[model samples]
Every structure is written in C-alpha cells, then in structure tokens.
Target: MQFQIENIPIQEVKLDFAKDVRLFVKREDLIHPFVSGNKFRKLTYNLAEANKEKQDTLLTFGGAYSNHIAAVAAAGKLHGFKTIGIIRGEELVRKVDSNPTLCFAVENGMQLKFVTRENYRKKTSEEFLTQLTEEFGRFYTVPEGGTNDLAVKGCAEIITENEKDFDTICCAVGTGGTISGICNGAYSHQQILGFPALKGDFLQKEISQYTSKENWQLMNDYHFGGYGKVSEELVTFINQFKQQTGIPLDPIYTGKMLFGIIDLIKNGHFAKQNRILAIHTGGLQGIEGMNQKLQRKGQKTII
Candidate 1:
C-alpha cells in the first residue's frame, strides 16, 4: 500500500527565559486531519516493509486511547491489511468516557480486545503468541507506540529533509523512537534532548540501547504521571500554549514534554546561545471533549 506523508507545519517560538534561545516547533499535529505526525512515519515505512515481505495482517499493543493504535487502524484500512489493537486494559469505562482518541480509532476500523492487567502482562508470552498466531493466522507485530527500527528510519528521513543546525532537538519521549531517530539522524554538533513520559530509571537504559549521540540525554523530572495520567499543571500548560500559539496539545503526550522543555530553559538547563527544535508528535484527537471535562472540574483554560 502507498501511504501518504503529512506536511506538518513548522513555527519558531521566542522565549524570554534565555538571552538568545529561540525554539522552533515542527507542528506535526498538522500532519493529518484524523491521524498525523510521527504516526505517519511509524506506519508508512513499516507497511512498505510488510508489503515487501508479503505480510497480510498487522498486530500491535497499546492502551484504550493509544495514538499508535489509532494511526495503525487508519493506516491499515487505507492500505489493505487487517489491523488488531490489543488494548492494555479491560474494556471497562468509568462514567465520563469522552476520550475522543479511542473513539476515533474504533471509527477507523480497529478490532479492540480488552484484557485484564495480569493477562495484558502475558501479551508477549509464548502461550499468548501461540494462541494469537492460531487466531490471527500469521501477523506482523508492532511494539507499542510503534517504536521500532523502521519507524526510527522514517524519523531519520525527517531530519535529513529539515537540514537545520539547531543546537538541540527536543521531543516528548514515550517509547523513545522519535528522539532516538533524531539522535541518530542529527548532525554531530547538535544535542538531542528528551523528556520521559513515564517516570522510571529504566528509561535511561531503554533509550541508551537505541541511541549513541554523546549530547543526547533524558530529563527525568517532568512526566506528570505515567502514560495516560494527567494533572492540573499539564492542563494549565496546554491552555497557555494554545492561547499563545493556537495549537491543541493532548495531556497524554506532547503537551507534557513541551511544557518541560520550556521550563528547563527557564531554569538554565538549556544554553542561551543554542537554537532548539521541538518535535510535535501530534496526539490532538486525545484532547477531544477535554474542554468540557476540564470545565466540569472548574478549570478555566487560557483561551
């Protein structure tokens, strides 16, 4: 299948925290109307590889509202592959389940299967694979958030095309694929900085195994909560950014990373003389109905 590439927008933001720090945001959120940004790179390249290898079905894992699953479902339907989303949690919903991101994924044609926390843990077990192979009839498995070699290769293409000399390339690290690719793709003179979306010491080893840039490092202080968790501060930052730049950032991913990078610059972690490039690995769909939810909690947006 021939996948379409999104031309995400790019803009430079000026910051008062440093003497000469200018941050450029590659607005990958604008990449696609439904599914966008890094998802394009993650899926496009892999699908091409699958086609080359003559694979018919694609299987992947994620939470109920995983951006990767949504993108894959959409991509698979457009291409000619069967896509299955092995959601992390059971299909249980608390009353106000307005997570537009997951809803969009269903609309795009994903077969959702809910599993218990313990069962989900066994998703990669030999027993699970054997059973799934019998059920799925041979499929290619993609890691959560599409963090794999092919996806990273696609990200590398993004850097080669940009050809900018920004001193630092900053992005939110969920699976570490995009940042790893940027580190691998960047010129030796630039630094590739990442803010973890999960709080744990393991992320260092996880990312280090994939990248070798001497200037690359992980910022551990930021993650509001582990994947899919949210907080008041994240909402505040998202609203503030949207008010100033008119971009919507879902609390689940990009918003948190962007908020942290700017804070780091303010705290003198980033050098004033260095230019920064921030990647917006779009997850806009997750923000659907976010305003109403926040309003119920009496949280007023910057807008």
Candidate 2:
C-alpha cells in the first residue's frame, strides 16, 4: 500500500528578466501521473489516518473540474479504498462525458454524487454530514478543496533544507492548505507569496487558522476573474510557456501563478539578486475540460 509518490526535482528556468534574479520551479507535478503536486502532499496523511481508523470509504467535495476530486479518486483507486465525490452543480451529473476530470474519476471507480449549489454549501454543516453518514454508512469525510489539519501537515514537507537558499517561495493558492503548510515549514527569513487562482481576500483568514507564521502574503491580482475563469491572454501565456519550458501548467492554478511571477519580476517587484522558487502544484488534469470551454467559445485553447 505504498502510495508511490516521490520527492520532485527543482528546475531552474532561464527567464528573460534581470540577470541577477534566478527563478526555479520545484516540479511537484512530477511526483505522480495522477496524484501529483500539492494534491499528493495534501492527501498523504489524510489517507493514512483513514486507514488507521479502518474506514473503507473516502468522501470529498469538488466542482465539475476539481483537481481535488480527481486526485482523491485516483488515490482511492491506488490505495484500495472506495471513493465518493460530491460534485457541485447537479447539472454536471448528465454531462460527465463532456467533463474530463469527472469522467476520469468515474473511470477510476469513484461514485459520483451531484448536488445543487445550494446543498453543496451545506457540505460543511454538521447536520448535512450527519445525513451523509446515515446514507453512506460511516464514511471518512474530507473537506471540500481538501484543506484540513492533516492536509497542512502533509504540505509542510514541500519545503526541504536544500531549498532554503531561496529568498522567496511562491505557489498558487486554492483552499490555502498548500501555502499554509509552506508558510509553517519555510524559513522565517524567506517570504512566502501565494498567487491565488480564485478571487478573494477571504483566503487570508482561512489560511491563518492553520499556521501562525507571518512570513506569507497572498497576491489578489492574479486570479483572471475568479475560480475556473480564464482569459485569452492567460491561455496564450500558458501555451507559450509550455513551448518555452516544456512544462504544462493548468489554468486553474500554476499557470496563473507563473504569469504573475514573471510579471512581477519584469516590473522590478522583487529586489535585484533575489532567488525565487515557485511550486508547481499540479492541476493539469483539468486542461481538457478548460479546452472544451475554450473550443465552445471559439477562443485559443491551452496547448
């Protein structure tokens, strides 16, 4: 029952920016083909805890194209546990074929349960969970976006002693677990900058509950519009980036994060001679779903 995930390598990207600045990407995406990047880190302990409790089922929440759902489903399949994904937007129930992530989850044997947006909100409520347990028979519940104490514990390992030379560590923030763990594990002298793919000042509060470190700051400007919202400019950047680096970035997280990092570097946001490391928290599984939307809109798709 080894999960088969491994430590990723750090790749230095030769960007056309200030020569004194060095940019590197910790390729967390290479950890696994399916349960890659931050998802792998976030689920490590949570899955182990479920096994310790003798729970056979893992229940979690996500949207139509949620990386969390896809990762959880894959992990369950790999580790021999039943998985249930409570997806937002009930309309997606009939459109699984059109959605790549959902389809993949179903293919991996994750039981899909579609809920209305209204009911999905109650997923965090005790009453709602009570009803779920009654129907599912004492399942292990993982919070939506998979940000919980165990998730934070797992993410803290993302930073290693070898990477301490970096002056600034950057990552894409989703539910905040990844960055929160990094914030806790990072050196006090290094600053942690999170480029959130979703729009909101609310993540600061959510992240604060996990770690007491003040070394992190969330950049609110990079989220194209909101969660799952992308622009032509972003698509173009993602395509060109892959061409330049041979690294594929997902529109939801890593792509937006790299865009913001390069922009900040070009604008002299970071002082000269700074060492920066960006975490490639993978969400590549959602590219097909995004491309489908782009095709329908007749816009450029991510390459």
lDDT of 2 by residue, 1-303 (tens): 344445568888898657879899999888888898889998999999999999999999999989999999999999999999999999998899978999999999999989999999999999989988888887888888889999999999999887889999999999999999999999878999999988768898999999999999988899999999999999999999899988899999999999999999998899888999999998899999999999999999988
Using TM-score as the measure, the top candidate is 2
Query: What are the Cα lDDT values of the candidates?
Result: 0.76, 0.92
Q: After best superposition, candidate 2 residue 169: deviation in angstroms?
A: 0.3
- lDDT by residue for model 1 (80-194), tens: 7888888776744442146565666667677666677788889878899788888777888888889888988877766755646778888888887888788888887888888
Q: State TM-scores per candidate.
A: 0.89, 0.97
Model 2 TM-score, all chains together:
0.97
